[model samples]
Target: MADIISLGIDTGGTYTDAVIFSDARGVIAKAKSLTTRHDLSEGIAGAADAALAAAQIDSREIRLVSLSTTLATNALVEGQGQRVALVMIGFGEDDLARDGLGEAARAGPVIFLPGGHDVHGRETPLEMERLQVALPQLAQEVSAFAVAGYFAVRNPAHEQRVRDLILRDAGLPVTCSHELSSRLGGPRRALTTLLNARLVGMIGRLVGACEAYLSSRNIAAPLMVVRGDGALISASEARLRPIETILSGPAASLAGAQFLTGLDNAVVSDIGGTTTDVAILENGRPKLDPDGAMVGGHRTMVEAVAMRTFGLGGDSEVRVDLAGLIARIELGPRRVLPLSLIGHRFSDIVIPALEKQVGSVHAQRNEGLFAIRTGLPDSMAAGLSAQEASLYARITDQPQPLTQLLTTAPQKSALDRLAARGLAHISGITPSDALHVLGRQGQWNAAAARLGLDLAARQKGGNGKPIAADAEDLANRIVQRLTRQSSHAILEACLTDDGETGIDPAKSRAIARALDRQPGVVRFSLALDRPLIGLGASAPVYYPAIAEELAAPAVIPDHADVANAIGAVAGQIRETVTVFVTSPEEGIFLLNGSGETLRFVSETEALEAARARAIEHARALAARNGLAEPHIELMEDADAAEIEGKRKLVEARVRAVASGRPRVAN
Candidate 1:
């Protein structure tokens, strides 16, 4: 059987990790490389090559390959993705107001057509003529399209029709709401579909890159992708519904934590470049969020581990809060290219720029900031506006000081938009740079970090004094702020799990007093109920301070850095399908599932049909996901009421799940 070795890969915001593992021998070898945002294939191939070389294994010996990534999660948190247009069928402007769809849609164009369906799976008059007139123009304005119709879950005919039109005419990727979730909330479903449409191009490219690299290496293995719930799915399935991968990396980390530590109950916190993901482990399993996975304040309908993702990480942008006298330091919600990294790549420009800023009498607002081209193809920049295109043109492959690039305040906004679209990257001081300055880390150019910090330290506080006396002092302040924010993020996740209401650890005075250990008339202290399992490449550098703040012990496993990669291959293939049977009228049952609706005169017949359809769909999905034979489980939730001593059926939901080990080559 050639030992049935499996290869796992995780492409995170800052790094790509690869691991070779076997069921009998465990992890054989692992390697990491800096993630290449411009072209992810470079990072993936680098990591894979290193891991294979370390293991001394031939590429042909690998039986299976699996992957997990934080790209979708990072994009959502940073509000970065391809520009997409939303097609709303039979939805009013008011519909966009619901579920924050208006905010999520951003400046993307929206086309509302007079076509949809009712709850009874009856179609309203569809205006295909109106759609025909608008789609041609809309296609030129965005990279992809999202089709969400009223009551799409009950009947997806309208959504499907629109999708077919967009795909056939414009040849652009289209996401239909019903294809994502069967839930009834039209606006929220539309929002999810819209987000999914935006991610298709990105995830598709990632998969294509992996497949291409594997093919070139002659590693003929079925490529699988880790889902948000730590299950494996075929790459093709992942491409169609990339939104399901929002927490893919975090979920894999949770599984990895449990496998590495053998802990049944603990709070697992995994820190990456752009986000820190926190989740609770109970009974050797992660808890699933019933309300759906909420990331970046958007409640998505994707099934995933109950994880709280905070935009605090090593590569987080270091911002100074000059509103207060002390000029408090705050770590990111937005990731920037670290100065240390930029210095390593372009030291000639970075070091000189920082030295000039530090030598100046007064530090400017954009003193230590720089921008560079992301190296994405010009095709990805197709939908840029005039201002965005102009700003993007000014940014070259070489780093340019933001101070030199932006002439006016409005130009700054234009540059930000360019960065948000993944067309450009802004380089600034980050915690990773702080670590370099303090001699805690030396992976990159420390001289550049020190220079950047010197400029940062010269900034005036509210008291009209320097924020810090020296570069080292500023570095310490930044590290301390990161620890504090990390503690708050962990506390908030715990409090939310404990069902605490209206109490945000970040803003709570009582929690602050406890964390700061401030003595008063009445002393207060807070501690986690369970131990903290910190997983990341920099966990050892930052987690001890975070653990101290929370009064909890921190456990860092030996393989924590590559946990996501390890977990990617240690997962099973799982597929779920939910079918709904609703009583639309007296003695009439309507069954809806898998984009099909059927009517039955008897309730018994409809329920049976729903269950059969759910099971068939689940098994098919499992098969498509590379599972040869799956074990099936069926669950039913029936809602009925007794009215006038007679049983009346409201709704019945039948759910079927198929799960099995991923098929591997012999």
Candidate 2:
């Protein structure tokens, strides 16, 4: 409606990036800011202000703003969602475990009831009085409600009735499972609905804040969000289907990669401050995994660009193992030394202060000094008395002798994970902990990690053996072992997802073991020939070798560090709707919405309808995003089944330019 110059923003774990584009100006400007985990809006505003400055234009010149962020994904991973109640119209306790719903529903209470409908739309008798009794208590505790019933898509009456009751009593936002996922499988559907409800309030606030920021700056652009599948959607639609934006960051990287390489099909990898993400693109579009994927830690059935994430990044922790067979491993991408430690080492300030306070020059005896100067945690500092603190300081200054210290602290945790199959222990602490130790999330952690590594190298191993003769090598190994496990797990998961039947357990383990070794891009390239494209913040550091390994040119564009932001800005609005058409009689397949029945015939007419539907859906999404004169691209696939007749699935994509032309400056 307004002149449609659009601004796109992408907020990652460590940075917030913004890009402003005008058709008239081509590309206006872009800006970046450090992401503030505490209050995300601060980072958003910072990025916006920077972008405005870069464009050298008043905020009023901006028309529409689109944003994609990791805020919701972070909330879920950090276990920080609002309280929610699961209102199941028909489910038993056994249903949770059977459908794999129990895992994601760990946060909320799953309430089962007596009402449900059959596949043919007939209602199962329900106990209204019992349900009424449970409603009040649930209403008091929960900020939101998620309603799911067996076969709700076939007969939503039971779910609707429950929704009506919840609206009257709970006075909270509610998400019907049927609305979120049109597929069968009650438990999976319920999980999706519950997740949607949990994130609704948080996402709403984030969007509202962004909108207000733009309004305050007089940027009147229509807001849009990049979906997880690398397609764009209106802000309102994204809010409704926030799950689709779970991997929005990675999707943006792929989009940016495609734009950079101008190659439709290739493997794209982005290495960032904390992780490296690898994904594949087909036909210039990021591939989508049909089964929902995991983000942070929870699993959700949202369409996202398929990717593998590794925690190996710049800020990982370095450690040594002594209780075990004399090895050292880094504890984190999350933990690190602060730059202040380096500054401290170059001066007598930190060590002298430690010696003065503790009344000891002995590194071990200077525990208080170690805590204050090196930013070690109380628990860790307390592990060392004043004498140990002095020793720690000596090692922090020249840590080649403290390998013994690193080795001793983590043996029990590693053994428990390996010997007891309790990976829970090995899951390292987050970067947040390291930040807290340093008194700042970013700068301090970096300094501490560097300082800690230098000190750790001086220690002995479990066998009373010296660590690697090379401190750098030892430091690198420790970091790799700690951060690479997640990468190992994700790659294994992808292999399993490739529809391999009855995978040999030994082969799976072998593959994981190889990946754990952190093969360079060359090794990975030999294994898989797909071209590798790097996208995350870490990409610059890792892509050259990765490109070499893949034996294909790797493209890292000007905005490579903020590839996701570019993707978020560059994507076109799109949507997808899947409808299954079938007939019980088995000869002809009838589409429910259109009442069009196709007899046993050639592929032409069936193909046309399927493509048309896909186009129609895509066009509608374009329209919603203010795209005028939308164009549709259709794709159709049909399968023959023994149980049901010929089934056709249609996928459509639509695109259009916004109605308003870009404004001319000067």
Candidate 3:
């Protein structure tokens, strides 16, 4: 196992990283390529080929291949995914109003049915006539379906029946809420299943493409995917429940940071093109969010790392705020194509447009902005409204100035809709462009970056002056803003995780003064209790300043840029199952959970049965996930209350965890 080679890949918002790894020698070689929005396989193959060539390793030498991806997270955040119909069994329309489920449910139509289970695993008479009539029409309209039944976790009979019916009649992928989690929250579980359904086709396509690429190269290896908890699962399992991988890339980076720095306690901040994820490590392990992973503003029931994902990163959209006397520089909750990289790839079109914009005397609206087609296939463009279709048809391969492309407010909105659907992209100045202008990062088109900055600097401020004296000054301001925001994000995550109260990092004036190191009569200072471990391609360039502001030491490990890929390869397979032993009545114990139900007269017998059942299910899952020589650990959480001078058992949760490395090539 130590000698076997592992191939690791991570698909991120800006780049796809690939690495060749050996447990004995550590990271052997790593490569990064621009992530292609239109087609992901091209980027994956490019990085893999480069890494393999650098390592001088043949495809046959690799025994394992693992991947981490941000596509699912990005889709949920940006409202991009395949259309999926939600079939809510035993849930009402009012259920959608909770947990931001209604807003998230707008991806497709939601259908309600009358069939559910009681907390004790009792079934409600299921009525499927409405579903039967609608399945065929839904199959044509949606790419997948999500079904959630009340109390389905206690007994998944209703969910299973609906799943079987959909698979048989509609022939479409169906995600059942009980299959995603055993928790009892119907609406939140439905939200998770709804999201999982939407991501199924997208993730399945990505996994299929990777498998095909590996097969073509004769890389015969078991493929695995990094889960949001930083554990590994078979690729097939990942494709079925990709919502669990919402924080996959960030979770992998946590493992990579721990492995690279050997740190037991540190704050891990992994910055990527689209977002900066912040989390803390204690005892060399990241904590799981008990409330479940919250992505795209929806609190889901999928178990994941307690990571605070802030929409502040390299390619974050840069805009100027003129509401105040001093125009403020702001970064994003929205990501756009960086001007530098777009110019690097399409210089002929980008450079001339930018040049013309910079050559103008007066500062104009959207002078530094451009829109380009992502080149997605026409099938993805299906069901586009007339306004969106018209706007999209006008967008070509060549980057067009936003001022020219969007003449009216409605057209501007239409372009936004098109971008949201992944059919188009908007390019503008970003921190990456700022880096290029400052000569700190030279991977892209620096001249175009300068031109874009110059055009932006020409904007008249609220003070009736140019925003900056020159492009270089404006670039400095942008970088400083990013550093300030990054430090705040890290501090916020630390404070929240440490269970502190009242002091919000973003809004606290005292905290701001401390970070800014301002001179004041009432002086304040802040520092982290632990060092900051920064992991990402840009960590070396940006994290030192962030660490300095927080008064913490910076640990930027070697190959930090490819840490996500390294984490994917270094992770082990792990599966967990939980069973419940509840006393619904006196003198009787009812056992249920994880899709199983049983009855017992004695509490001792029922508790023991729950333990064995959990262990059995956990091991079965581990085996199915390719874990060899698996080790099982059990945890007992018993609940009791004093009642009438006697201690009565209320409930007991038996949890079993199975873990081991993936099986090597036979």
Candidate 4:
């Protein structure tokens, strides 16, 4: 058999990576380009073209193409998804108070309907007059709709009706709670569907852009997308159910780590410009979160890899905390546009502004920072407060120094509100600038970086002393702080996997002393049981120290920077179907999920029927999604209780999984 070729692409917060891979030769060529937030296709095409040229291979020879991305995860973490209208059946506004639903619904509006099902799949009289009247106007406000009904999993009649109504009337995308998860918690499921609706248009744009690029290049191949579970799905599935791809980039990186290291168990860490993702691999597979994946403190019912996403990255906003007698450095829980990047892009504007700030004898409170209008449309800026609107009207494509931008007392709060809404960006001294100052990274303007760092260093701490002696000193401190935070993130992830939760490695006294490594009678140390495999372009510069701090061997393999792209092409397709059987009374068995409910007289007969149906459902789904010749496996879990010398059936769950290696396009 001859080797088959595949092209893989991964879009992240900072860079878009592309790779050309062979089943027999492994990675042949890889490249990266800056991610253009406004138009992602530009970045994807640039990296793909570079990789294809490097490999010297004809595009037609590529039999497969796969993609993974961090846009969804980043949007959820940064609170930047599109507006969505939520329809809750048999749920009132009070339901929004549970599971942080009200806060999650901050991006859009909610509607309540008097329709739903009971625990046993009994229906309530549905009311559609309100929704019918609001559909026309809502279409102008929101890009998508989410439908959730009480006990929808038991009987999704009301949810399906609402979905059909939205699609037929508004013609916009719709997400239903029951389709996402069959779990019993109505509020949590609604939260998941609401998030899915918010992300639909964003992910849809990404996938459509990639497809358009492929068509333009005459590269006709099977298009696949990496799911959050590190499995492959057709791009069509990604378009309809993008929430499943929340952690797509991180999951692909985990698979890439396994492929590069060939390790059975290890701690994997990937650092990008916007965030750092850490996960643990057990027996060569990243563990799946059983309770669902949580991002940005919002627990969503999205089944994804068990990983910790920290907002500490290269472009993280670097701030000096002056709380105590000694000043401390703090990295970001929010990302910002790097000063060096903006300086390089608009050197005429940003560089001159930075120079003016550094040379002025007058010290400004917002020194070394600038505000630039984010490229979002004007419609998203609607309903801004009077002050926010005033400040926003002044910000333009040209970077405005923060010192002048926030002249009034109320303008400061207005800028914060604007930034929170993703209407403007604060460009300041970030770790990327620090790296440029230290001469480790030179892709951007170094002079601007030096000036920015010098301005930040001159600031007085709580002790009324300068934070650092010079730019070089401040740069080193930032890098060291990143290293310490990275180590703590990795340790925190590992500890969480070991059933230990809520232990802050960064603040723990013993752990801090251990990482600090200062001599003392009560000395402490930490060591990992497995090696640390690092991925990302910055891994080479950052992970060595992180691994050393944890006393673990660092595996910085070849092509580490493009690992996510490599993993996108290196994975297989997986489809799963779950069937549930329950007994509301003796001598009666009911089966539901994946299809209409059925009744059986005997428990044994119901279990047999459920297992067969599950396998059939999985096989049918895989084939529909372009998986060729899938092999299916079945697992059954049954529950029962003993009472009065007889066993009573409670519930039984049967799951079938189908998987197979990806096949070449015909």
In order, the Cα lDDT scores of the candidates are 0.90, 0.56, 0.88, 0.88
Model 2 Cα displacement at 288 (Å)? 1.9
Query: What is the per-residue lDDT of model 2 for residues 1-666, given as tens digits with 9 covering 90 to 100?
Result: 333456778876567888776645545688887664345677789988887788888787666666777655544543445567787787888877844567766656678889886643456886667658887776656667788888786557777788888888767788887656556678878877887887776666667767778777766667777777677777777666676666677777787788767888776766544455567777877777776756655556676777655444443333345677766464433322223332333334443433233343333411221211222122222222344444344333232212232345543333322211101111122323233333433433343343433344445677766565543544445434533443443344345446553654224655544544455654422244455565655455445654543345666667676666666667766555544343334344333221122342433454455456545654555676666565444444454444356444332111212222112221
Greater-lDDT candidate between 1 and 4: 1
Per-residue CA lDDT of candidate 1, range 1-666, in tens? 356799999999999999999878999999999998788899999999999999999999999999999999999898888889898999999998998899999759888899788877788888878778987787788898889999888888888888898888999889999888978888999899998988898899899989998999999999999999999899999999999999999999999999999999999999999999999999999999887888988988888999999999999999988778889899989999999999998999888888887788765768789999988878778678898888888899999887788888898898888888888999999999999988999989999888888888888889999899999999998999999999989888888888985698889899899999999999999888889999999999999889988988899999999999998989999888888888877899999768677989999999888888999999988988888689999999998999899998998999999999988876
Determine which window of 10 residues in candidate 2 has minimal summed lDDT. 418-427
lDDT digits (tens) for residues 1-666 of candidate 3:
358899999999999999999989989999999998767788999999999999998988999999999878877777777778898988899988998889888868888889898878888899999999998788777778899999988888888998999999989889988888977788988989999988887788778878988998998899999999988999989988899889999899988889999999999999999889998899989988999987777788878899888888899999899777789998986789999999999999899988887777766777788899987766567557788888899999878999788888788788888888778999999999999999999999998899999988878778888899999999999999999999888988888887885667888899999998999898999999999998888999999999999999999999999989998998888898988888888888999887568889999999889988999999989998998568999999998998998878888889999999998664
Candidate 4 stretches greater than 4 Å from native: 92-94, 133-137, 377-394, 407-414, 417-423
Give the candidate order by descending lDDT. Answer: 1, 3, 4, 2
Residue-level lDDT for 454 in candidate 2: 39
* Residue-level lDDT for 576 in candidate 4: 84
lDDT of 3 at 588: 86
Q: Can you give the TM-score per candidate against the true fold?
A: 0.98, 0.70, 0.95, 0.95
Give all candidate RMSDs, comma-separated: 1.3, 9.8, 2.0, 2.1
Better model by TM-score: candidate 1 vs candidate 3: 1
Which has the better TM-score: candidate 2, or candidate 3? 3
Candidate 1 Cα misplacement greater than 4 A, ranges? none
